[model samples]
Target: MAAHKIAHASYRGPSVVKEILYGISLGLLAGGLWKMHHWNNQRRTREFYDLLEKGEISVVVEEE
Candidate 1:
C-alpha cells in the first residue's frame, strides 16, 4: 500500500479585509431597507388620516 500526503491551506490578509467589507455592506443594505419600510408605513398612515379628516371615508362610532 502507498501513503498519500495532504497539503495545508493558509489565510491571507486581503481575504479578511474583503470579508469585513462584505459584512459592512450587508449591514448597510439591511438598515436602508428598514428605513424605507418605516417611511412607507408613515406615508400611508398620513394619507389615511388626511382622507378621514376630509370626509372622504366614513367611520362608525358607538356610544357606550
Candidate 2:
C-alpha cells in the first residue's frame, strides 16, 4: 500500500476596498438593468391601457 502526502496551501492578504468596489459596481449594473426593464414594462402597459381606454382595440374574453 502507498501513502499519499497532502500539501499545505499559502494564505494571501485580503483587500476589503477592492471587494467593496466590486460589490458596488455589480449593484449599480443590476439596478440599471432593473430600472430599464421596469421602465419598458410600464411604457408597454400604459400604451396597452391607453389603447383600451380610447377604444382603438377590442378584447374578447371567453369565460370557461
C-alpha lDDT values of all predictions? 0.91, 0.94
Off by over 4 Å in 2: 1-11, 61-64
In model 1, the runs with Cα more than 4 Å from the true position are 1-14, 61-64
> Worst 10-residue stretch by lDDT in candidate 1?
8-17
Worst 10 residues of 2 by lDDT: 54-63
Q: What is the C-alpha lDDT profile of model 1 across 1-64, one tens digit per residue?
A: 7888878787644787888999999999999999999999999999999999998886877579
Error of 1 at 21 (Å): 0.6
- TM-score for all models, in order of appearance: 0.67, 0.71
Model 2 lDDT tens row, 1-64 = 8988888787878889999999999999999999999999999999999999998876977589
Q: What RMSD value applies to candidate 1?
A: 3.8
Extract clashing residue pairs from model 2: none
Of the candidates shown, which would achieve the greatest lDDT relative to the real structure?
A: 2
Q: How far is 36's C-alpha from truth in model 1 (Å)?
A: 0.7
Model 1, position 42, has a per-residue lDDT of 100
Q: In angstroms, what RMSD does candidate 2 have relative to the true structure? A: 6.6
